[model samples]
Target: MKRRDCLKAGLTLPLLPLVQKAAAATGPRPAAGLTRVRPGAAGWPGTSDWDQLSRAVGGRLSVPVSPFLGDAATRSEALAQLRNPFFIGDQPALTQTSGYHGAWLSRPSARVVSAANSADVAAAVNFARRHRLRLVVKGGGHSYHGTSCAPDSLLVWTRAMNQVELHDAFVAQGAAAGTAAQPAVSVGAGAMWIDAYNAVTTHGGRYVQGGGCTSVGVTGLVTGGGFGSFSKAFGTAAASLIEAEVVTADGRVRVVNADQEPDLFWALKGGCAGSFGVVTRMTLRTHALPDTFGGVSLKVRADSDESWHALVVETLRFCRDTLCNPHWGEQLRFGDERTLGVSMVFQGLSQDAAAAAWGPFVAWLAARPQYTLLDPLQALALPARHMWDADFFRRHAPHLIAEDTRPDAPRMRMLWKGDQSQVGWYLHGYASAWMPSGLLDDAQREAAATAICAAAAHMPVELHCNKGLFGAPADALAASRATATHPAVLDAFALALIGNAGGPAYAGSGGTVDEADAREGAARVQRAYQQLRTLLPAAPTYVSECDYFQRDWQQSFWGPNYPRLLAAKRRYDPEGLFVIHHGVGSEDWSADGFERRR
Candidate 1:
């Protein structure tokens, strides 16, 4: 079945055996007290109004005419789904069935128009403005807060706009028109990192600092100030953003770049997605294929506090060196109560050079009696793609890719992939996406270790790190100077340290995850990370991966740029045509779980 069809099938999927009643319970409830979730009726903008949206698009318009969802019932429907079987079913989330949506957070917009080109997007925007209907665009819908989806809104799905091209002879502005500009690639809004990488490699370079995962859309990642463990050697991929084709809220299609609409161009780099406008295509710089060799995955169990302490101390030392190496592209996933693993790869080096660089870290880990190294992709003489089965898993956390061959491909978790055994809360889509700015200093690291030990006592403590992803301040500063991304990006010691809360699934007969569970899980993780977030030198949060619950999220995510971004929003989207929680100027509006009230 098509991805959207599979996702649509998820809607009527039988409620988990446990949450059959209370989970899907309708009507007003205490948890929803703060914001009322009223069901939709056939009163406003009925079928004829929706038919107009179809006329406005160059693609399909998925309109659920049922009164329960067509108008505003999605307010409650969205809230309820975020709780139970919706998020923790056979699939932990509304998995990315299509390019535009990495998360199944979308509800019945007035209609879901699958825009095939820029004109369709322009038409949809004009229609939304004329009717004053809420307009939401789904660009690789991978938001942690699920901001891409909204109730009683017009959802423009850009998933069908998947096309890629290479500009081998193009020259950038500022330089003499004839000066040799770097080779660049143009990806459609629906293109993913894997797709971009695959296309680029076929032409030349095997690497493109697109995103951490394979399925993550290029449009969302690049626009949100992306970071890749593999790209640490190449700096942020967004730094390569040379141009974009955007359909602004004013219903005008303009090309934004360093020379044109410079302000909007600057903001689009890291101001997060869906704020300024909807991009149809993006142009990013690509590097020549580097000669990388020697990749390995090593792991040891921390079954005891003493073992855990040793692992923590060793981690501090390894990072001290790893963080300093700009050319060392490695992946490390640690913090689970009983395990500490490191996946190291040396790019732009020979086997001997690679060994020399990581030999100490490897030997030190091996000599430790407390460590039990598990070697899977320990191929010592191949690049990541040649060594790993899935190209997406290669740049991302390859250690998690099953050590043993499986009969079927791994199930996708939002934009990434995970083994079937872990297709639960730990997956990308199942868990909340947060990028905090905090370092585990001598004093802080110890405390964090203690907290981590407790948090991961039972389940794996999911974490991600690489030589360049939040390795230190210098890396972030370099990335920031290139765009208006969050200042926290510079301050954060790690790209992300997901708070260890909630569970894989609530298997009880009628006690599956609920709205309260979601709120609590979010709060619990926030409190856990707060201890370190408060100590950071600056507030840094990833825009592509966002959560509204953060303290001063706007300031934390955009830093000083938030003011400028707000101004830009006011200028381009004055009517609040673009509204997303935690997005620029979102503070001007309030939500009652339904339409945006002026």
Candidate 2:
């Protein structure tokens, strides 16, 4: 039988013995309360209830067991697996990021629904709602704010739902009769950006805007205002969305788009994941491929504070004039050690053109005797279709990619070497702010440069150029404006990120967490962000990558769009069935999302 047919068949079976016993004990409906029930609590579902659910979902439900619960040798193997994001994703109890100090720690759910299709997801959502259980949704398990994992919860794990398909000509569900069909790709919620890139770009010879890190989940990234290495050219992943299949709190399977349930559709586009519903699949518009994709990398150190300030000012001027367009993206780092780092990517430019664009800046650094070249500048370009081709990288530039070493792993299962550090990182502190485009103006450029240098005195600060739409094409900006992301991004030149992390320190994983150093690093990171905020006070931040404990998250993450998002949340999930840290309507619940505010 087909999976969907099996789901229908399973739901019709007689109630299991345990479920019947539990139904008799608790009556027909769940008890009314302001708090959710945890394990061993009154009104909690019985074994029979879970068994019935498992049967309904084709026996996909299972109790999650932490790898740390195993014997010494088993634990060692688990620790080794932490370095591989694919391995971490495959484990129900693990997340790409282990935890954040004093905020949230990655913990396994009481049970997990390893969903294989939308029917499985609907079953899990219905079960959680009926039982009044704390529900958690995890796709790639890469939530930096720990939104993907929670203790004493029922997890809808979508990792096994990965499936990618291409569409040559697609139209919205209820478009006008003459609406033109557009090229697009329909991606499973559980699929990572790499999976989409491989299908849409590497194989299909097209482009779909997505996260810079290949391992980021497609649904999670889009729902949180996704940005990629080429966002300056294509806009956000959310903006590229054409349609989404979502399962709301009431278990109604909904296909939402611009012409149907438009509010919910808008909310799904950059509204914040796990707020409105669980997305099973999404169709995103694809663009024509550029001829080449390229990158530039270099490092320089200044001998004195004066030189460092000069370096920062000059670099800002260069970015404002030359690199602010659609061709440029990625980051430029300013470090505490009086160092400047260039780690940027480009699209539609040849090797010589890209190199020539940076010629003046390179000459300026070389002319200064106090500036020493720490890493020689390198500018390179390649066929755009080969950008995400794992085989191409492995054969030519092995150092640029890290492959999954498991003998059975797919050959395409690889991540950028630079992203390997984040596989199981434990966050000490992290914060981000949008730097207004005005900062690049001649009159204010010095102030912006000064703020950067001052912030770096405490910790490194990275300016992600593509996160802001200052120099993007008009259509890209208009599309972003139609989404739920903060309007501040429309006028910003870059998003400044200041943060630090330690190695994997998951509890009981045999990895020691340095409390003192973590505390100190957290303090420094906070101070660095504060220094930048002094220049651009009340600047908004990206919801996917922002301060975990932000006091005014509503304003900082969505600005004026929060009210609209909250209304959509009430319309679709009035009972507050879905919740995540700082997500829409989250203020109505406690920190752990277990207790109602009233």
Candidate 3:
């Protein structure tokens, strides 16, 4: 059934009376100040109150069932399910990442409102606010910083709302009369990138800018300045946003766009997630699909430090002169083991063209006797329409994809084999810094290469070329500039990301935590990132994938846009009803977002 049809059907249910009663019982609204109530607190809701909430949301409210808990057989099931992102997302409490050292561990909320529509979300918001309860939001449950789950809090779970619809020429609800309609797609907050790709690209023969990870939540990605494998070609996912349907802190359903609630709309694009409001659904502009999409992979080991430094210098020069354009994206890895790894993607290019593009660099490496080729340099191209087609991979290259093995799972639901390591991994430390495009200039290339080698001396460092917009098209840069993302990205040639993590380690999932190793790894990752920071001291970071303990997050994540975002926060959610770690206006509250400071 269509999403609109489902919403219409849901509205017919008797859900209004409970909402009214909950508001009425709260009497005069309390001042926007206090510590939220947990279970057994003086202001905590009773059984009857919980039952009323359940009824209001059409019996969708329930105690979250944690896979980490239960008996031996259940524990075994949990271990197996950790490998499947689909199974993990289906659970009320499980996050795609288990946790980060000394940061947070994934914990289930006391209760969850498995919302199916905007009305249900509003009901849950009203209940949480009226009862002075701590609230959490979860969709794809992929938060690396552990923002999606909290102990003893109420969860607004949108996992049941996954829906994807395409449009030929869609206009925002409040767009001007003469506003030209554009191709777009409307995605439920719970929908993953794979779902959007399937609907828009695989079936509709179009493209929607989204995250590189197919299982990432659409809403979370766009709201947090998302990047994809082809971002250099299409810009950021946030820049493609047309409109959104959001549930605000006051329980009002708002349709925000450039013409309506413009401030909120701007904030919604590239602003931190779970801060402004609860996004029920969003519409993103789509683009024509390129005929072919492809990738290049090569791994080489350097025999000596001297050779490695030369390799780094040559690689940077090659990138600046040839691959630093819209056609190239993805990473170039520098490891502590004196190795250089290349895993990059290209759009609008054929196998031959892609091979030729890397020909000079390949030949340069071949001439260096001190460098040994660890893997055969390969360039592969395929029909762009089949890029996310699970059946295509299953039939042609089964090793490239991992299917959802459950009997009831959809055939198209699969995870890239490369992404399997991150399924339930626990982060040690992660840090990213935007490297200025000038660093690749003839005069600065040597300095940049030196910093890279020094950084890798501590740990492996990857440069995600697509995350920066230095070499992007003008229109793409303009759209990104208009959003709330840090301006540093606009002038950056690449984002240097360094991190380390351990295997799956949830509390009761039978996975053991290696505290000593985690601490040591965290230190190493910090040292590696600091080495790059020496080159670009004031570089800004991508909010979604930054350090857990970032000190100057306001400047690091949003830069000059923080004050504006804070204003939007005050205007739309004055009471701080929605809060996440390091999110806008979070400084006014405690770390866990339970107690208001000022």
Candidate 4:
């Protein structure tokens, strides 16, 4: 078989390519490579193969099996864990459970080798390579593109490898000469952000730049250039990375760091996980914990179309400029029916500084500029009473910084549901993109305006940015000396203005819609937002947050870095054992995996 052909010059944007139905890959004449595997292909660890794999991994394999149905006790426990579609990272969620954000986008292969350590992982890789089977690496199991798990592949489940270690000084050899080695945290790939957070706090004052959600896996977040409230203050999660222990395609455990296997080191950070190799553990730089402040939850309610658009634009601006102190962080959420909610926090900002920072933003929200000269009756933005009482906001806002995932914390969701009390709903889908800091050009804004107005219903959207991620001794927005996060991350935080965009999908009446109309609606949504992506050329969406259906995905995900990344992929994974959909070397594989792309 052959590798990806990306030598074609120039960027070609395919806004939305046709998604072909799954078919077993065949008819490939790529010399020197193994047979290409596809979804629904017939091949696997049949009973004997399963037993061998189980033995190889010391009985760590998990497969679908029937407990005598008559045994009520065993059956009851099994049903609670295995069949739930939305269970978030519970041990027995979907074979392809999307870590903490289980989207259930694809069915998973029924078999998984729950490898405990790097040696076990290496053995599994050699097994998959020997059989020419499609493989997926499930570090946190949370995959936006579903690359972490697949339907007919041998999955390396790393959920059990939850280990955390802290070091006082992590000397990075390849750091630019003047840079000093800093304290570091070494976390297992399967460990969640909370685990790392606990370790940092226990170490006394340090914190790692990572997911706001406690359950988000450190490995997955960093792989896609992790951004959070603290990111602007520190840098991206990827940038903070100092070292990693990886299991490569050749079944060797390699220590990858700036001085070790530098190219692989570069590819791992922001180049994304699963595309290079399985990262068993990661060591990242940590920052001293600073004083943190929280802002009140401000709700902006708008009853009309003009009001919603203006509110979203203004709120984003507030986050971008008005309150954009490097030490401060906030979340801007847009809910259905033109409603906007904001939750903010700050660290190391004194009360007086905090008040000064919130001053202009609050005043602007309380008194909005009028958009028209004619309509005297319509209040400019949200009516006074409808806006969350500003005074109340000033008094009751939170002091917490990172997400609180305790049982009663608002962000906590019980991944394991024992009864009807758990929340349940269908997620239509979630799509996001990065917007460079700037107003949408007229045409782009108009398109969003038109789409939102015609949309069947209100869409939940959010605009998030880490003002701190853009800071530095030099220019925070400039490329970092530490890790390989895309430089586009430093561009103004303009979120692709997704129409009907982000908090959560609004579920409607229980009636089902015509499948054909649903498809049409999806197409329309894709076109409307895809156009918006075109306007913001400077800023690319975070690879982890955005959908993979954009035009020229490789360029959009990684600009000038694509060529270099492709070269590295060719060098490290020669047979292309690691492939992320639309990732570095993925151009070589067809979307269906049935044919290699030219």
Q: What TM-score fits each model? A: 0.73, 0.94, 0.94, 0.74
Per-residue lDDT value at 116 in model 1: 90
State each model's CA lDDT, in order. 0.55, 0.86, 0.85, 0.55
Top candidate on lDDT is: 2
Q: What stretches of model 1 exceed 4 Å from their correct place?
A: 1-43, 46-49, 64-106, 172-180, 329-331, 344-346, 350-356, 365-463, 467-480, 491-493, 499-527, 531-539, 546-548, 592-598
Model 4: per-residue lDDT, tens digit, 1-598?
Answer: 0000000001224322221111112222244334555434665446787788889899987762333232677555534433232233544224222211223333455568887898889988888876677778776555556667556667788877879888887776565567676788888877876567656753345667776544557898887776765565666778877888888889899888877888888888888868888899889877766644333344556657777666555555556565444665545555555655554545565556656765665566557643221211111121112112223223443221222233453232212111111112222334555544334334344544444333313344445546224333343344243445545556544333332111111112122334454455445555545444454433455676565465566656666566656656766676777776767667677563324555
Q: How well is each residue in 137-253 modelled by candidate 3, as lDDT tens digits?
A: 999988888889889899999987889989999999979999999999999999998899999999999999998888889999999988988888788889999999999999999
The collision pairs in model 1 are 18-509, 18-510, 40-73, 302-338, 336-461, 488-539, 488-540
**Residue pairs of candidate 2 with colliding backbone atoms:** none
RMSD of each: 11.3, 9.6, 8.6, 9.7
Model 4: worst 10 consecutive residues (lDDT sum): 1-10
Candidate 4 residue spans exceeding 4 A from truth? 1-49, 64-87, 92-104, 172-180, 302-317, 334-336, 350-356, 367-427, 438-460, 467-482, 497-524, 527-534, 537-539, 592-598
Candidate 3 segments whose C-alpha is farther than 4 A from its true place: 1-33
Ten-residue region with minimum lDDT total, candidate 2: 1-10
What lDDT is obtained when candidate 2 is compared to the true structure? 0.86
